[model samples]
Target chain A: MKVTVKLFASLRKDRFAVDDFDYQEGATVGHILASLHISEEEAAIIFINGRHGGPDSPLKDGDLLAIFPPVGGG
Target chain B: MESLKEYLLARAENGLIRLSIQAWAVQNFGLTFPAAEETILGLNLLPARYQRNQRSLSCGQQLSLFRSKVAVIGCGGLGGHIVEELARLGVGNITIVDPDTFEEHNLNRQLFSKLDNLGQPKVAVAASRIKEINPAVTIVSVYDAFTSRNGSVLIEKVDVVADALDSIPRRLELAEVCEKSNIPLVHGSVGGWYGQVTTQFPGDYTLQKIYSRYIGERGIEKDLGNLSFVVAMIASIEVSEIVKILLGEGSTLKGKILSLNLLDMEFSEITF
Candidate 1:
């Protein structure tokens, strides 16, 4: 399965801004984060196809996943 | 002061009244500038001070702005800039809440912080700065934190609240207060070159959705540090949302979060 991954804010500093990867069938959102060396704590919000998704949420082929860090400063 | 109305009417030409007329009315009728201006506006006359806002905002919209009250929590980084813009936009009454005082480290991004005000209360500095920007604006500065006990009364008089707080837990606490009070919150946060903004209306779980996992944890900003540009940009966006809410113009970020990364210049909106 081919999936597009988008990392925002500080998450992009050490990671690719956007990239495509081929994952095995039934890859969970957590699996992709772990593969990218991004811990669950590092990614504050996960969006699958523009909607909120959790780590355990399963991803399918052609799904766009966006990850954001918590930019919680005044 | 019955003749005051006729005097103002005489000075008004083509439905537009000059600030000088307001000055005259203020002096003659012992009314404040805002009072005189509001009276003339109520009579269907436009004040020349707001002439620039004519087309962008109808007379009615301008009046709505003048009648709106907004509370800005946190007088640092985000709060400072938000207060400055709100005053310039002619928001009639503004309540500024913040307990911390300025330290030397805050000069980089806090708009009201200055070398001379290194130890002054943030709210006091914000109040004085706002007076300089717009004298007609009424400022109620609370030199305390917005806790559960005081949150309700502090925001009781405000029509809307701006969440410029720094902590995740405090933001959640503020959300609870806003929800209970039935007031909308325009939320903004920044860390380094990244920032996020969203509008949380009554019953909206926008904040909870974004910071639920990060409760009691300081944001990455502590390590990345906040930048001046990021704070200013996010603050401007927050103020724009407040203006939109007050005038009932444009679409707000309700149920959505607008995440921004100045480093990559990418802005993405995510809906829950």
Candidate 2:
């Protein structure tokens, strides 16, 4: 199963902006984050194929997973 | 008063009047500049002072902006720039709330802060700067922090609110107040080279969704610090959202957050 992963804001500092990952069948968003070395706390918002997704949400092949860190300031 | 109206009408050239007519109306009729401008617009006459704005905004839309009132919470990095833009855009009334004084640290990103104003209150400087930018804008500076107790009174008369605050708890509190007041809020935040903006209406739960896990935690901005360009960029976006709301034009980021990363030069929009 091939999934395209995208990271935004500070999440991309030490991580690649976009990458392709081959995961096992029925892999959850949490599993992807763990594999990318991104802590669940660091990924504020996650979207799967442009729809809001949670860590427990499962990702299918050819899905686009987007992760963003909380950019909170004034 | 009838004679003054007649004088203004006589000054009109092809149904378009110059700002001098507004000045005359203000002096003779004892009407404020904005009041005079609105009366002129109501009579289907256009003011020459708004000639530039007429290109992008219709005469009616410009009048709407002149009649709208906005409240900006916090007078630091974001608040300073937002107020500057709003005044230049001719928002009739602006209520600025902040209790902090400008220190040396604020010189980096605050628009109104200067070496001479190091000890001055942020709202006071904002008021002075607004006056210099557009005297037609009436600014009411509240040199107090925006807490739940004072939020209602401060924003009761504003058509919209801009959340320029740096604290998450205060942002959440302001969202609750806007919900009760039924006013739309334009929210923007910046950290280092990154920034995010969104618009929240009553019961949208947008801010809560963004700050869900970090409600009590401080933002990463504390560690990375804010960049001047990022603050200006986010503040400008917040002002644009307010303008759209005032004119009732275009789609707002009501339920979505637009995040920008200057380092990566990437912009992303997420809807929750």
Predicted structure with the largest lDDT when compared to the true one: 1
- By summed lDDT, the worst window of 10 consecutive residues in model 2 chain B runs over B211-220
DockQ of each: 0.78, 0.66
Please give the lDDT score at residue A16 for candidate 2.
86
Backbone clashes under 3 angstroms, per model: 0, 0
Off by over 4 Å in 2: A24-26, B13-21
In the range B1-272, model 1's lDDT, one tens digit per residue, is 45878888888887888867777788888999779868877888888867777778787777788899999999899999999988887788999999999999999999999999999999998989887766678899999999888999999968899999998889889999999999999999999889999999998878988886665456779789999999999999999999999988899999999988888798888888
lDDT of each: 0.89, 0.87
**TM of chain B, each:** 0.95, 0.94
Top-scoring candidate (DockQ):
1
Candidate 2 has an fnat equal to: 0.69
Compared with the true structure, what per-residue lDDT tens digits does model 2 show for residues A1-74? Answer: 99999988777776788999999999999999998888776777889998987889999999999988776678
